[model samples]
Every structure is written in structure tokens, then in C-alpha cells.
Target chain A: MTDAAAPTRPIILEAALDAPPDLVWRALTEPELMARWLGASDIEAKVGRCFTVRPDGPVGEAPIACEVLEAEPGRMLSYRWRATAPGEAAALDTVVTWVLEPTAEGGTRLRLVHDGFPVVLQGAIRGQGAGVSTMSAVRRRQAPDLRRRGDGRAKMSSGEVIKWAA
Target chain B: MDLFDFDEAILEADILRALADPTRRAVFEQLARREMSVSELKAGFSVSQPAISQHLAALRGAGLVAERREGRFAYYRAEPQGLAPLIDWIDRYRAFWPERIDRLKDVLKDIKP
Candidate 1:
């Protein structure tokens, strides 16, 4: 069984944009607009729609594969992103969620959460170690640890602090 | 080999893949408390003895755990240093997001109403 005490910690980023929620949403969801600000992407704002984001440079031309998980116009958006380098059989999958709240001053308060990384890693490790059958239980147990580790305060069974190496 | 010469992406991927299992994580955490032999570790989990050995092998492969034989029995302990690459990878995003947001702000300004 998974540990209940630890929860997956998402990478959160917040920004207050001097624009309305609809404007901010369009910038984030529109491929042309997103390419100008974020990266070159052909993403649509519909749940289950798959897309890709190809950024220019030495990072190679392998695009980031994405699938929209949630899409609420002018409010919230979430998607699963996977990056697979050429010649590698395995891909790193992560989830990115965006929450937009309209401010009293008419600006947009944007919060972004990138999650599922640690669990993905943990699932791979567990499958290799214990076999694939136990992955769900292991993932449930690992969620809390991922969340706890994100905040930089991971605790062991003995209550000893497990500090991340700098 | 110089540590700086290590390919971080490859190393980080390998490390993450190795420690991704819950059983291995528990084993690593158990070892973090104190070094233990295979039989001793087996007592803490409901899995078969062979399963524990498999978990240990993965942990060792990732360099997250180390083994030392004392006579017939081999004891394993957590090697915290092995986690450095994963931590570094996470830290990069922590630093990268703010700067990206600033760039986004500039992008927003250029957009017409």
C-alpha cells in the first residue's frame, strides 16, 4: 500500500499579469501566441487533444509531446507533457496545470503546477524492483513523499530529516 | 573522469528510473536509518526474499545504495550522494520559472488588446 502521509509536491509558479483573464488565457492556449511567449506549439484548448511544443536551439529538434487533461476557458488548463530524446526508448512524462484567477484590479493571477515527475520516476523504479503488479500500491504510497520532497522536508520512518543534496 | 564531464541528462534519467519503485524507495529509506542485511530487510516487508534482492539490485545499479559483504551476509546502506543529479535537475526549474515568467510579461505587453 502507498503511504498516506506523504503527497506529491507539484512545481508551482505564479505570475500576476497586467491583463484580463481572457487575454492571459488566449496567450497561453493559442499556438501562435504561445510560440511568441513560451515555445513553438500546436496545442488546442480541448481535453484529450494531443500536441507538441518544439523549441529552437541546441537542445535538438525533438518536440515535447503533450495531451490536454483539463481545459476551462479563461480559468484553468492542465496537460500531460512528455519529452523523448532521439534514440531513447523511455520518455519523461510530466503534468502541467494552469489556474487563472481574475484580480480585483482586472489583472490575471496565474498559477502553474508541474507534477507527476517523481511518481513517474518512482513507478519505473518500483516496476524494476518489485515487478509491475505492485506499481499502483507503490504509486499511492509514493505520492505523499513526492509532495513532501518538493517542499524540501522529506521525512523518514524514524522521523529523521532527509535533506536534498545541493 | 571529471565529475563535471558527466552527461547530466543521461545520468539523471538513469537515477530516476532506478529509484522509481516504491519497494526500492522503502529499502533505501530503511537503509537510511541503518545498514541491514538481506534477511533483516526481508522482515520489514511482505514480499518474497527474492523480490527484496531484486529491489536491492536496482538500487545498487542506480548507485543509490551500496553493499558490503561481512562474511556470508551482505549489508546495504543508502548513498545519499547518488541523488544529487535529480535534486540539481529539480533546482534548475525552480530557478528557470521566474525568469521565464518575466519573459512572458514582456511578451504580454507586445500583444494588442
Candidate 2:
């Protein structure tokens, strides 16, 4: 899992499913079924609407506030994911998109991408060593000092953050 | 590497180009807060009316912003649909986390107190 480095570009992941495209589409758009796998109590997939996704076991924070960016029945869906609570480093909300194509074997080729990594990752790779231009130095260097600082300013726990950074 | 595997890259490039300009970025920031017309966008910044129009044109071309003609004025707002593909792509990785946690739970269960 790489931090999507490009501000405008998206990080893509693909999966080929044995199920038909229609079946996959239902699994994606149908909120009740999607919750079984994806978690969250209320999910409205319409464009311009808001949805809440509460994943179990604390991956980041609970109940991320999401705004529907786009949706095309049976083909594509996109939305913005952002932390709902305040006092967390104000981050540029990230975007996620999914595209489904019909494969030759009557299955679906699912393509997913999330764009807008925080500038800190790019700074880290560039050897800036300091945090992102926007983030506090403590947060920017949290990976190297996870054991020392477990104050929990970030949505993801230290272990979770380290695993994600890896 | 299959460079052309994702056309959303092309879409992203276009969005980036639209955002390259300072005025356009400010325009987007304004729209993020609330829908506004071309005149309203002009008011938010110190640029000339024609300059704001040019920025709006660029944003509209990128599909990052959409316009609707209401009476004599044109209203513009954030095109949330345009951003959907990017957001959904990121969430795909979230699926892997639970499995990893489950594995760690198993390891802990195996350990003696």
C-alpha cells in the first residue's frame, strides 16, 4: 500500500472477480450488502450526498465523513474520504474511484484508485526529513518515533500507521 | 509498466492542469464552501472579471467544476461526481487491513499469558 504520491494522479489497484459484472455492481452499490463486507451503518451512494463509513476495530478513526463525488450505475463510483472530527491535521480530502469492466470470461475486472497523498510522504522520499510543509514536525516524523509518541493525534494508531507506511 | 492501464490518470492530469493556476485553486476553494456565480467568484479574489472567467472556463473544461444557468446569472459549484473515481480508488486498500489484524489476533491467541 503506497501513499498516492501524485497530488492529482491516483494510485490504482485491480482485481479480477469470477462473478459477472452485474453481480459485482450490486455488491458495490447495494448499501446493506456492502456494509456486510465494507462496514458502516448509513451509506448513500448518490452524487453530492454525504455518507458515513464506520469500520470495525479502529482502522484510522471511526465514521469517516464522505461526500459522493460521482456514481454511474453498474460501472463506476467515486467519493471523497476525510476525517470527520477536528484538531487532526487539516488534510486535503483524498479521492477514491472504482471502475468495473466486463472480462472475456464473463467476470468483472475491478480497478480502484485513491489520489491525494499528504505532502509529508513526498517530503520524506525527497529527503526533506522534516514533516510535510503543512503538517507538524511531530506528525511528519511519527513513523520514526512511533514508540516515543503515542499521544494519538493521528486517526490511525501507531502500529496501524507504521503498517500502512510500510 | 502498462502506462495506459488507467485513463483516470489522463483525467487526473486534466484536473491538475486546471488547478495549476492560483486563481483556479482559489475558485475551487470558494466553491468547496458554497456554490457561487462567476460574479461571486470575481468578488472573492482581486482579479479582473475576464481573468476569473478564463479560470472558470479552464475548470469547466477539466470537469472539476460545473455550471448551471439560473435566470440571468450562471452558478458554479464543486463537481463532486468528477472526484468520485479518485476517492474510490484509495478506499480499495482499506480492505487489506482487517485481514492483517485477524492474523495478528491469531498470533496473540497462540501466546501464553
After superposing the true interface residues, what Cα RMSD does each candidate give?
Answer: 11.4, 15.3
Q: CAPRI verdict on model 1?
A: incorrect
Residue A1, model 2, lDDT: 10
On the 0 to 100 scale, the lDDT of residue B91 in model 1 is 46
For candidate 2 chain A, the 10 contiguous residues with the lowest summed lDDT are A157-166
For residues B1-113, write the lDDT of model 1, one tens digit per residue. 11111255556556666665667777877776668999999999999999999999988987878999989889998766666555544444444455556667777888846
**Reference contacts recovered by each candidate, as fractions?**
0.11, 0.01
* Alpha carbon lDDT at B34, candidate 2: 62
lDDT of 1 at A87: 57
Model 1 lDDT on a 0 to 1 scale = 0.66
Give the TM-score of each candidate.
0.72, 0.44
- Candidate 2 error regions (>4 Å): A1-9, A87-92, A121-166, B1-113
Residue B72 CA error for candidate 2 (Å)? 63
True contacts kept of 1: 0.11
